[model samples]
Target: MTLRVMVAYATKYGSTAEIAELVAATLRDEGIEAAAAPASRVADVRPYDAVILGSALYMGRWRRDARHFARRHRRALRERAVWVFSSGPLDPSASERDIEPVPSARRAMCRIHAREHVTFGGRLEAGAKGRMAKMILEEDRGGDFRDFDAITKWATATAGEIIALRAEL
Candidate 1:
């Protein structure tokens, strides 16, 4: 049977949602069944063999929806292969090096027994909905720093790992 994966994410201005969609698409391309959804809308994790949970970071904290999802489904998530990601670095530092998870993400990962956590570059654009975002744009710091190539690479590797686990099972 094909393994089913959920790419659930929380985003303030939709960049992280797009990343989640790409992840699901990449997994599907790798022959796995995957779908992306908002973390808040996912009422259950029982239907998925694995889950990749992601959130947009602001001020080094995860979105409230993502935090609630992790807490609300912690038990179910522990029973599945769980991975976590954060997107927030407006700079290329995420692509240049491995960035550590924020304290909240670290806590959630430990609580849910997540298999891995990754940090990815973030995007900020004009018309984004936040005072900080507006200020960033005004200061010319707003741009799409997300590296799709890196995202695809990570998703491909995640698919390989999931497939290998299935084989062993």
Candidate 2:
């Protein structure tokens, strides 16, 4: 059977959404059928053979929509292969090291019995909404810190794992 994957994400300013799009695209390139969508809009997970859920991190926590999505789909998630990611940290830290998921994300992973969780660098360009975003820009601390290479690499590896798991099944 063809393995269908859903790459669902919650984003406040679209960065996480872009990451999700890239992940889905990479998975497709790796021969897995994948679709990217907003977590809030995904009311059903039964159609997907696996799920990769991501969220934008703010103030060291995941966006509310992402947490709610996990809560709403916890049972379905547990029955399928699940992975999670967080996009935040407006620095090269994520590219330099493996950052642990924030407390809430960790809990969600445990709740859903996710196979893995990853943290990716975030982007905060001009016109990004929020006072803190503006403040960071004012401080010259804002830039597109997302590492596309790393994102692609991770997605590729994830696709391989998903394929292997399906073969085992």
Candidate 3:
């Protein structure tokens, strides 16, 4: 059976969306059938064997749709396998430490039990940012800073895990 994977994401200014697209492509390249869609439109999780949900964090919070997506699908996701990633710290100068998980996200994680959760430094486009976003951009130390290589490698590893699980089934 072809593994159905979803790269569901909530993006503010499209950077995270690009990341989600990259992830979906990476999974497809590994022979997993993957789809990319905004989390808000993901009404059903039953069609997918595995899910990779990503969110863009701004002002230390995920977009509302991301939270709602997890809450709505927590039960269904726990029955299968899921993974979560946060794209933020748009400022690479910021410490590359694991963020203190939020209450809602933590509660949902405890219940849904996603296989893995990771945070990666994000990208910033100076032209598109607003006041606060611009402030955040100003603080960036430099470079593309999106870490595409790491993101692609992690995505491949995620697909590998899903492939192994499918084999066992």
Candidate 4:
């Protein structure tokens, strides 16, 4: 059977959503059947064999909808192979090493016993900020910090894991 994966994301300014799309594409290229969708719009996890959830980090927290997505699907997620990712640290000079999923995300991951958790560098667009993002935008240098190669690498590895697991069954 083919591995069916869902790459669901919560984005602010659409950066993380792009990352989720890249991940899904990479997985598909690796021969896994994958789909990317906004976390708020992904009403069910039952159709997927595995899940990769991602969110934009802001104020040291994940977007509320992402958190709710995890909580609402906790049981189903726990039963499947789950991966998590956080996208942030828009300052071009900031080390991606310093970026990681925040506490709330960690808590959710723990509940699902996530297979992996990655923090990817994010992007900042010229005028994508909302009214509330103004303060955070002040600290942002406004650049594309996402590492596409790294994202692809991770997704490829995830696909390998999924394939291996499918073989074991």
Candidate 5:
């Protein structure tokens, strides 16, 4: 059976959206059919076998739309294989050193029983018009801190887990 996965993301200035697309592509490369869509635009999660949700973090909180998506789909997500990711850490040193997910977001993920939640470095462009992006651009450590290789690896692993879970079913 083909595993259809939805990579839903909430991005302020498109960085997280780009990451979500890359993840969908990587999952496709792993032989899983996947599509990426804005979290607010995805009205239903029942069409997919698995979900990979991500959001751009600002001040330790997920974008409001993403949080809403999680809350709206909590029931459906709990019945499927679910994974979560947070993007937005200008620090490129280690994923662990990045800021943690806000308390409420953590609680939402717990409600869905997300298999795992990974934090990836985020990108900040000087030209981004968002106030938060502009503020982040002014930081001394600012640059494109995103680790594409790591993102690909994580997506591939997620695909494997989805396939394994499918076998179990």
Candidate 6:
């Protein structure tokens, strides 16, 4: 059976959406059927064999839609392979430092016993505007500090875990 995976994310200015696509690509490379889309586009979870949810963290919290989706599907998620991640916390040395993944984002991880929960410092363009983006822009140690290599590695590892788990069934 093809392992169907849903890679869903909530993004404000498209960065988190890119992250979700990376995870989906990793999953697909592992011989699983994976797809990526916005959280708002995912109508239901019952059709997928597994789910990987991620969101952009704004001001120490995940996007609202990602939170709600997890809450709505907590029961179904508990029975399948689930993973979580958050993007958006630009630290200059994130490549070496262990950035704290938000607890709110990790809530679904606990509920589903997810294979992994990852946090990647996201990028903010030079002109990050809007009230929230502007606030995040105010923080120092900031720049486009996204570690693409590390992100791919995390996605691959998570995919490997899911693939191995699928083997048991």
Which tens-of-lDDT digit does each residue in 9-128 have in candidate 5? 999878899999999999999999999999999999999999999998887888998889989999999998999998888787545564556675698689888888888888776677
Query: In candidate 2, which residue pairs clash?
Result: none
lDDT of 6 at 118: 72
Runs of candidate 1 exceeding 4 Å displacement: none
**What's every prediction's RMSD, in angstroms?**
0.7, 0.7, 2.4, 1.9, 1.7, 2.0
Q: Give the winner by TM-score: 3 or 5.
A: 5
Instruction: Give one digit per residue, the lDDT tens place, for model 1 in 58-122.
Output: 98899989999999999999999999999999999999999999999998899899999999999
TM-score of each: 0.98, 0.98, 0.88, 0.91, 0.92, 0.89
Estimate candidate 2's alpha-carbon lDDT, on a 0 to 1 scale: 0.95
The global Cα lDDT (0 to 1) of model 1 is 0.95
Give the lDDT of residue 160 in candidate 4.
94
For candidate 2, lDDT tens digit of each residue in 31-137?
A: 99999999999989999999999999998899998899899999999999999999999999999999999999998898889999999999999898788888988
What stretches of model 5 exceed 4 Å from their correct place? 95-100
Q: Give residue 64's lDDT in candidate 6 (0 to 100).
A: 90
Taken over the whole model, the C-alpha lDDT of each candidate is: 0.95, 0.95, 0.81, 0.86, 0.87, 0.82
The C-alpha stretches of model 2 lying farther than 4 A from their native spots are none
TM-score of 2: 0.98
Clash count for each candidate, listed in order shown: 0, 0, 0, 0, 0, 0
Against the hidden true structure, what lDDT does model 4 obtain? 0.86
- With candidate 6 superimposed using the best TM-score fit, by how many Å does residue 50's alpha carbon deviate from the native? 1.4
- Write candidate 3's Cα lDDT for 71-145 as tens digits: 899888887888888887655532455665555555556767887877777766767557886775577632345
